[model samples]
Target: MIQILVIAILSLIAQLVLPWWSLAIVTFVVCFWRSSSALTAFVYSFLGIAIVWLGYSLWVYGQTDGVFIMRISQLVFKANNAVLPFVGTTILGGLAGGLAGLSGYFVRQVTGNQSMSHTA
Candidate 1:
């Protein structure tokens, strides 16, 4: 469908230009608008990811190198505070776009049938 195609293309663009939250926005949109089946898929996907992340956390909690790497990365990004406003704006914009798309999809669904006019 054209909607899926457009979402996929935008997702790829977001991956290149945005942070991890952009992917979350995509997931939310796909889960919300595509179908109930897609919503279930999203739930299962998150469940699987949670399991994997929990396992990895338990396995790596004692690793010294991971801690050192995390600390260094934190130091490197400490200056992010200076640009927090820009980062916040970018995140909010992506969220707004995703929600707008979802709303448009639902609007089409509701108005698709003349019989559904009352519901709309």
Candidate 2:
């Protein structure tokens, strides 16, 4: 239906526009269409995407920067380290990506039943 399409677009927008809590709105909308169970599906989707993002970041950092995570870990114990800001930024980026994934998951879950069905 048109409503589901609109919701899917909005969810994609939430991922594109916001970083953290992107799914906050989309989750509510999906719940309206499905139920709270859809929220769990969204979380799983977010986690799956977040893991991929994290792995990609780690790989890139390893290739270009070398031992970035080790340096970050050391910075965590050392309060005056300069890498703190970099680590903080990385966390924020991850949050954004996670939110986007959450939005995607909810959109799929909400629309799955309607769109995936065979209508004669």
User: What Cα-based lDDT does every candidate model obtain?
Assistant: 0.44, 0.48
User: In candidate 2, which residue pairs get closer than 3 Å at backbone N, Cα or C atoms, i.e. clash?
Assistant: 19-96
TM-scores, all candidates, are 0.29, 0.35
Worst 10 residues of 2 by lDDT: 31-40
TM-score of decoy 2: 0.35
lDDT of 2 by residue, 74-116 (tens): 6675554535545555455445544544554556565665454
Residue-level lDDT tens digits of model 1 in 13-38: 66568873464565455534453342
In model 1, which runs have C-alpha deviations exceeding 4 angstroms?
A: 1-8, 11-80, 113-120
RMSD of each: 10.5, 8.9
Best by the TM-score measure: 2
